[model samples]
Target: MTAVPVFLYHAVSDNPPRWLAPFTVSPRTFVEHLNMIADSGLRVVPLRQLVTTLLGGPPLPPRSAVLTFDDGYADFASTVAPLLAGRGLPATLYVTTGALHASGTPSGRGPFPSAATLSWGQLRELDAAGFEIGGHTKTHPQLDTLPRTSVREEVGGCKREIEDALGHPVDSFAYPHGYSSRTVRTLVWETGWTSAAAVRGPSALSSNRDDPLRFARLMVRADTDRKRFELWAQGEGAPVAPFAEGLRTRGWRAYRRARAVTGHPYRALPTDEG
Candidate 1:
């Protein structure tokens, strides 16, 4: 019962916005991390391939893994894509449709910094380059707190928007902030997406027995040094590393859920609170 590890990333920039600092991995560190991946002997595959194989499409080669980027940041095009292109590596970029229309501002607590959303042209280029363009909803909402109809719009509408823009099918979906509910998962599947992504730190695993809609992704943050990155890449530090963070993510989600039930009204989506 081997499990494939999927690495989740946000922005790659030398100077990440104060609000996004925790998730930002500088280009230098990203390059180092890629170098390590190249030297690690693991085969990096696209998110589609992983989901396909997991769904009984075909067997994958040994030591297989997937790389995915959430929130369509402009830095991905300006910085990350070129590096991946040079390496001939394919990754999935989940886009939030509403953010692309933003005023190109930088460093904010919004779904993306003003300048973070990639332009439609860039997204198409990425698609043309064999990268997967998935949906991250229209406005990057927290699916669990929304009504089923609203969730459908968030999931289905975003898929339709991306597919229309790229003139291709958008089969992958990622929940904003790695938060989702069973209802949310069902809506994702019902929306015609083949798979969806979630984060539960190292606690998440993508084995044949795992749910495709709830595919687990390990976060790669700014603080992930070479040593820690290597351990994560090799699937060695799941218990200790992600578990520590998982306690917090899990606890927060629980708190949000309770608030939702009490009609106290949590944020409609995640925000980088100071």
Candidate 2:
């Protein structure tokens, strides 16, 4: 079983909102992680390469890893992109379309907390710069907990919004807060998404056998210390994906759905926080 670390990141900044701080990594630490990946001889490949392999197109080069960022934070344009461009690395950035800052207002109403998010112009620039821009829903909502109609709107509507903005089709989608059920995944595929990202909790690495629509990702957070990250880079600390969804996951989903029905759904937070 060849393990591929599809590293997930959020905001990369020294100063982040209190709510986002747990998921944020400082620029210095981000550089260190990149350097460590290079030192370990692991190649950072574009996410589509891994997706192609998962789709049975071809085998990935040995020791290949992926870089993906969820939620379009302003720091991605201001800090993360320059660093990645400097290293000549490829990455995929999934943006919550509604949360994007445009003019003096958000493009749409998103469920995310108050923070500096990427604007549409910045996203276009990032796309032009060779960064793969993917969809993270119009408003960041838990897809599994929403009604089927709403799921379609969120899943398909987001693809349309990004395509309208970018003037090209985007193939990748990521579940908000890493929550997705079978229904949600089906909706995503019906909406024409080729690959979708999900957090398989901590210590799980995506592999060739992982589901293209619900591939696992190893989240890199503020608390992800050097030792743990190094181990992940070596594919030694995490279990490879394509595992069965356990009873605990189903129970958690039930609880969240119940909360949603009561109009008191869980607030958006890092995937591990729930």
Candidate 3:
């Protein structure tokens, strides 16, 4: 099986919020990872190329990988974009509509902790610079735990919001905290999303056979060191996707759903990281 590693990143900064530090990678480390990808001889492709291959459109070039970022962090505009643009690499950026900074607000109405998020104008500039802009919900809630109506509002409403702002249709969507159930995925598809990114625990890679609506992604975190990243770039350290959802994952979801019922769901600050 051909493994395509779709790398997911959050904040790329030396100084991130305390809450976001776990997922943040310094600019220096990020550059090292990019160099490692080049050294490993893996081509960085746009996410839609992988999606097209998964949907049976065409076979991906050999040893292709993807770059994707979540939550629209301000560092993406200031730091990440220049680096990627310098390398002429393509990437997809999924933004939480409600978390985007606007009108002097540090952050919007999302569940994320306080951080410098991207502004709408900056988002447009990023979009214009050729980075694919995708939706990450309006308020960054766990879709699987919400009611169907709320889920629809979050999923569908986000697409509409981004389209209204960007003046063009966006096809990619990423599940907040990488949590999605059958119902949530169905709702995402019904809302017209062509692809949705999901983190498959730690050290998992998306393959050609992976589901387009719930494709696996390998997360690059603060602790993702050189050895591990090289292993992922070589497609050697992770399990490829199209595996069954384990019993433990189901149990965890059940627990989170139970907590949601009590109106006190487990807040996965940025992600579940499990």
Candidate 4:
């Protein structure tokens, strides 16, 4: 069997009443979740270390796992950081350079659902503190929509920025908005990143031709109950769905739903555009 699942998370919150909007696993809940992973005998591996180990001589633990957070939320530093440290677990934090500070707007993904995104300085602290830091992008732009030049710049520039800040190479990436494509993956590899993550779930190994930057992820969300989270982490819950073709359709449907609820009208992208 494959070593272990790669789990992705947003906010490990202390008090997120609903999993829908806030997307936080309350700090108390987060602790429980962490304890669960720890007790399950899984090695909480960082992405780089996991990759390096698998490529080296020895095999990994039967329950090895990679914990990665996208968007560089502030809670990562203020909340999740200490907890992982206490458990002696290593984590990889993927960040969007745009949201690292006061430079860009927050995601509709939620209202400050992750109100605590990290800054460049905070990122450096995390890097210096031994947390592995990686890139998302400068503006969190959808990688597939941009032209080739923009894709290269967005992918490369953010890695460049993080490396410049932390004095270490940013060798991995997570697609912004969980969005990517063949073109985007090519650009990511061209940028020389070792690996990259996607929002899809049910983790497995990539074959030789698989894009190094296009790995999938499972989630232990704030809303997940212990049983479901366990099943998910164990790869027995829901099978990871291939969702690349659903983007524009789902997004447009969601937009329409929001508009209808608010009694507002909107124009969706032309049917041919997606």
Number of the predicted model whose lDDT against the real structure is largest:
3
lDDT of 1 by residue, 46-151 (tens): 7777788758787777678888998888898889989999999889998888776434433333466544567777888888988888989988877777789999
Per-candidate Cα lDDT values, in order, are: 0.76, 0.89, 0.90, 0.66
Residue 91 miss distance in model 2 (angstroms): 0.4
True lDDT of residue 87, candidate 3: 98
Model 1 is weakest, by summed lDDT over 10 consecutive residues, at: 238-247
lDDT of 2 by residue, 177-249 (tens): 8889999999899899999999885548989889999899999989999999999999879878989988888
* TM-score-sorted candidate list, best first: 3, 2, 1, 4
Q: Is candidate 2 or candidate 3 better by TM-score?
A: 3
Q: On lDDT, who's better, 3 or 4? A: 3
Candidate 2 stretches with Cα past 4 Å from truth are 103-109
Model 1, residue 156: C-alpha shift (Å):
0.9
Q: Which of candidates 3 and 4 reaches a greater TM-score?
A: 3
Q: Alpha-carbon error at 152 in model 2, in Å?
A: 0.5
- lDDT for 73 in candidate 3 is 90
**What TM-score quantifies how close candidate 4 is to the native fold?**
0.76
The number of the candidate with the highest TM-score is 3
TM-scores of the models, in the given order?
0.87, 0.96, 0.97, 0.76
Q: Taking the tens digit of each residue's C-alpha lDDT, what string does model 3 give over 49-164? A: 99999899888888999999999998999999999999999999999998886645566346566788898888889999999999999998888889999999999998998998
Write one digit per residue (lDDT tens) for candidate 4, span 1-274: 3535677777776643343334567788877778777777666776775566434535556666778887777789889899888888888898877667643544323222435567677788888888889888876665665668988988999888888888877787888656666778888888988788775422332222223456556655545689987765565565433324455555754565466457673432101021
Model 1 lDDT, residue 57, Cα: 80
From the highest lDDT down, the ranking of the candidates is: 3, 2, 1, 4
